[model samples]
Every structure is written in C-alpha cells, then in structure tokens.
Target: MNFNQKELVKSTVPILKTNGTDLTKYFYRRMFKDHPELKNIFNMSNQASGKQQHALAGAVLAYAEHIENPEVLINVLKSIGNKHVSLNISPEQYDIVGFHLISSIKEVLGDTATDDLIEAWTQAYNELAQIMISIEEGLYQSNLKKSGGWKGWRAFIIADIVEESSEVKSFYLKPKDQDLIGDYLPGQYLSVKLFVPELGHEQVRQYSLSSAFNPEYYRISVKKEQNNSNSPDGIVSNLLHGKDKGDEIWVSAPSGVFHTSFATDHPLVLISGGIGITPLLSMLETNKNSLQENPTVWVHSCRNEKVHAFKEHINVLNKDSQWLTTHVFYETLSEKENTSVKEGRIDLSELKDEVLIDNAKYYICGPEVFIKVQYNSLINLGVAQEDILYEEFGPQLLHFN
Candidate 1:
C-alpha cells in the first residue's frame, strides 16, 4: 500500500496492459480452481462470453495507467463499488480476488516476476482493494443512516406487484418493519438479490427505479428475459416474474450516478431505447412540479406499443406538464403508427434535425450498443461530451471514452 508499491506496479503496467486478458483469464482460472467457492460469486454466462474477463482486465490496466492520477479513477472505482455491492462482493472477497490475482501474475510472468515486482503488484492490489472497500463502506453507511436501512442485503416484503407488460413487471418493496425510507435521486437504480437454486448463493442485477422516489416504498420495473426459453433463464428477472404479492425479496438501497437536478437552469434532453424508459420516466416525474425556465424533452425509442413499458404514464405526464414534451419512435410499426411514433432510433442526424435546443444537459441509459452509439452520435452532433451523462446496466460496459 506504499507509494513505492504503486510506482512499482506503474512501471510494469505496460506489460500488464498488453497481457491484460491473459492475466484475467489466468486469475479466474486459478481462482475457480483454488477457491471453487467463488464460482458462485461471478456471472458464469458473462465469463463464458469473455466479457467479464475483459472487463476486470481493463479495469486493472486502467488502474496501472492512471496510477499517477488515482483521483481520476474515482468515477471508475465508484461504478465498480456499485457493482460489487450489488454482487454481494464483500471486503473478504476482495482478499480472495487479490490473492489469486498476484499469484496469476507470478505464474504468468515467471522469471520476470522478481521479488520487487511481486511486492509492487501485491501493494498495488491492496491499495486498489482499499479504495473499493472504502467506497463501498461509505455506500453502506449512507444506506444504513436512512430510516429503514440495513447493512449488506436483507429480505424485504413485497408490498405490491403490478404487471407492466407481458414481458415486464413492476415490484413495490418495503422493509418488513414497514417504516419510512430515504429518498433517492431520480434516474437511479436498485440491485435486487435473488437466490436461484441452480445458480446457488444469490445473483444480482440492476433495474432502474420506475417511480419517483418516495419515502414509503421503492419501485423497480423489470423485463423478464424470455428471449431464450431453452436456457435456464435470467436469475433475478425470472425469480421476480414468478413471485406474487405478499412474497419477500432482498432489496438494496437505490444507488446510481445518473440523476436529474433541477437546481441548474440548464435545458434537459432525456433519450432512451426499449425498456430504458424506466429511468427517464422517473426523471420526468421528479421534475413534474418544477418551475425551471428550460424545457425537458423526452425522446424514447421502442419496437412497438405492445412492448413499450410506460406509454400511458408518459402520456398522462405530457398532458399535465407543459415544460415536458414526449417524442415516441417505433422501429417496427403500422404505417400510421410509424408516422405517429417517429420511426427508427435516435441518431446524430435525427438529433440535429428534430431535437432542438442548445446548452442542454443530455442523459442517456440503455443497452451497451445503443447507449454507446447514441452517445457518440450526440457528440458528433456538436453536443459537449462533458454535459452528457449515462449509466450502463452491467459491470462489463465501461464508458471511459
């Protein structure tokens, strides 16, 4: 944890950067072999896709790359903090991961892994783990300070359940004690933990808060992954789909960076694709009573009416709020619906031609491909990159650029 340790790790970062994937693969292989108990800790499906390995490797490389500027890695570490919390990744687990990571480096590097080199990586891993542990500890404290709060994860009774669509469902959760809850920022997400027998332990996934933050209960809208019935199915989403009223599920306090602050007079443009509408809807609801001068434009894209999650709710908000304007685009629709719902997705040309108003802050959240392509397009359309905010769903999707 010494400065020299970070410096040592920094010196060898280039080599680690080049072999990041190999290192991560080695790390995971050794981890699962030595501590097979961790098999339940990671998402096997993502590991199979090579996404998780690449993601962890990318982060370690970034840490080395930014060793001199650790402050710059705060956001990156914060995102990781959120993911770790959701995954139930504890401080103890960090030791497990760190132990094997160093071992992997020694095994892979062989003759190159001198005593000094090993010490450097050991210290670097400890430092990095400390940062994550501290951030996560702060998060735990924040959640615990609330009226109805607990550390780690706890079972919450399902106060109510509403069906949003054939594929999507909404769950209203309240602590078993039935006490008031702390308010969360609009556009934040909550991690629900489900104990899937097949998956073992518990698996976590993030779902955006569909309803405005209320002190009484939290609402999360989820789309069941029905795309592959032949597969085992989505761990959290599937578990949520079958549960009914009066059931119990574990809930974490809402946490995310994407938020709508009416404190600023800046104009706002909220864009979403598919079920990404959840967070935007929360933003609109939170701003419904605001008297801000700048307008808030919501442009949402979906396949059609059947799968669209919050059409009626959005329509009602549009009627009630004058500062809000709703623009709907359906990719595959009837000729009339296509004209009514502004056909296709939101792109650079579409923003330039249709979405007007400058000096506005843009907030986007959705699938990896959609958010990335649209975010880049917005920059191409002359929007300042600094003013744009986004939150990706999983740990693998890093938006450094």
Candidate 2:
C-alpha cells in the first residue's frame, strides 16, 4: 500500500478498536440478509451468540494494529487458515465478505466514511484476504495430498458410540467406503457437517478427533451442548447425540494448527478443563508409547467424576507408564473416585518444578475462562511465550503479549 493509504489505515485504528464489534455485527447482518445460503457453512449458533461477530471484530482490530508489519500476524493467519480449510471456504467468498465489510464500515461510521478512508480499507482488506487465501490454499493442497486424504467432504458411518460421561459421547466414524482415512496430527480436529432438521439447513462444527490418529477410523468426543443459562441448545451436537450407529455424517479432512509433533525435547505438560480434554486425550494417547525420552504430565479439571469422560482409559494408560503422572481436579466429591483425584480448580503453583522448567511444552484447552487462567498462570510462572499453546473451539479472542 502507498504511504497515504497506510496513514489512512493507521488513523482508523482507534475507531476500529472502539467500534469494531458493532461494525462486524452490521457486516454479518447485511451479508446474511443478502446471502442467506451461507448459513449452511457458518455456525448460526455462534452468530446468535454474537461470538462470530466478536471474533471478526477482534481480527480486524488486530490487523489494523499491525498493518505496518503484517508479518507479526503469521500465527494468527495460520490459525484462521486451518479453520477456513476445515470449513472448505472458497476464494470467491472473499469478494462477498470484502464487499459487505466495507459497506458496514461506511454505514457504521456515517459521516466519517471519507472516500480516502474507504479506499484505504479496501486495499488493506484485499491484501489481508490474499494472505489468508494463500495460506488456506496451501493447507487444502497439503491435506488433499496425504495418503488417505481428500478435498471437500466425505461420508463417514458412525460405527459406534461410547458413553464417555453424562454429557460427552464418543462417536467412532469410519469412511463409508471402508477406505483408509487420513492421518491427522494428534491435536487436530475435523469439521463434521450434519443436516439439522430443525434449522432447515446443513450445519458444520469442528470436533477434536478424540483418539490418537488412526487411519481406519476417527473418534470424536462430543459434549451434548444443552441449553445452559449462557447459551442456547447446540444444533449439531444435539442432532449428533440422537444419531444411531449406522448414521452417516459428512466429514472434512482433518485440519488444525494445534497439534503435538513431539518434536521438542521439553517435558510435556497437557492441561485441560472440562470437555476440553478431547484433543489433549489424542495427544496423550499418541505420546504414551513414544514419550520415553521426555517425561509427560496430564492435568485435567472438571466439575466432578460424573462428567469426567475418560477416567478408566486414563487410569489404564497411567498404570502402564512410569514417566506419566495424571492428576484430576474435581470441584466436588463423587460417590466413587480414584487416588489421582483432587478437589479444586487446577493450580500449577505446586507443580512449578514440572511445568515452569525450561523447554516444557504446555498445551491447554477448555472453556474460555479456564484456558485464559491456565495461559496467564503459565506466563506468570515465567514460561516462554512460545512454549505455551492453547486452543479455543469457538471464535478466539485470546492473545499473548
């Protein structure tokens, strides 16, 4: 971009910081009004909760803040690219989004929407879109090139459903054609698309592949997202829970920026809160036989034993390994429990020696608040920023300094 355009974008940073959410909300409303069919790809549930709006708002603000040195946003781009690839987002849609986004800027800012400012934002959005498109294109190509991978979506039959906990069920999916499935990174997730009867449209949601990467089958543990005080009933999850063994669902190739390569020699610290343990469980399972050189620790927090998903599986694995220490924190007591149980939220202070040590890789996932607490705790304990990684299921608003 030219100097004039860069200066124009810089001038709008303060406005975006203050009203980004409102602008994004308008953008979604206008875009949806014109392109209602897009609802099939976007999560309308997240839209209703304003989560999608807030997420885009945060992204725009971040982009505006780092417009001068866009390289700083590489991590952000990779994360979003993984998500886009999983959703099978098309490059043509970028034009649709850019149109409505700039329109929203004009409508929201009213008198302040000068032609110069609009032109600057248009150029900026185009550049950012290209960056995202390039990253997503590469991800799509890589996923398709894998041994058992394919582009778009493929049908998978639900071979079995294991009742993991009161709220979580593990669905074992095998390719409908009985062909080999792709080998995904341990911490990755798959975008599962289901036709919702009530919503009258197909809905897509990403579920972490709950078990270690297996070419024959993929397992995803889904917590029935019931209507809580904070949110409405989850459309796809409820539908999935009601499905029978022979039901077929469409699943995309596995894609996610968060994964355990076991590449680093750091002592692995896997922390999770509630249902967030799904992806980490896969990482743990994959690493159990291989983590001989690097000592590993699994820390989990949930409400109680009843909601705990994989006690038996974890216990079995724990008994088999000398280097793995498993700790479970339950907020309340249960009728029966294991010796590894504790009664409180996760506290890493006591385990400082294990977690705060140099080269310790920390992977955390959970509710927004829980993940944030764990992330800040690790940072506060003096862990290097790059050493800690966390994943959020919904729109990610969290960032580290």
Query: Which candidate tops lDDT?
Result: 2
Q: Model 1: per-residue lDDT, tens digit, 1-401?
A: 56776778888778877888888988898998888777655777677767888999889988888877878989878977876775567889888898899999999999999898898888778888999999999887887897665666667888898887667788898887676666777888777767778766656667888887777788988888764655656667778889988998777777777787634477778888888888877887777645553578888887777788877888887787778777887777776553557766765565575555777888887788888887888877888778888877666565644
Clashes per candidate (backbone, < 3 Å): 0, 0
Q: What are the runs in model 1 whose C-alpha is more than 4 Å off?
A: 1-8, 36-41, 228-232, 262-264, 289-294, 336-338, 353-356
lDDT by residue (tens digit), candidate 2, 1-401: 99999889989889988888888989999998999999999999888888999999888888988889999999998999999999999899999999999999989999999999999999999999999999999998888788898888999999999999999999999999898788888899999999988888999999999987777799999999899787778888899999999999999999998898744356889999989999998888878645443677889989998899998898898898887888889999765766568888888887787666556789999999998899888888988888888999897878774
Residue 186 lDDT, candidate 2, scale 0-100: 82
Q: Give lDDT per model, in order.
A: 0.78, 0.89
- Each prediction's TM-score against the native? 0.91, 0.97
lDDT of prediction 2: 0.89
TM-score, predicted candidate 1 vs. hidden true structure? 0.91
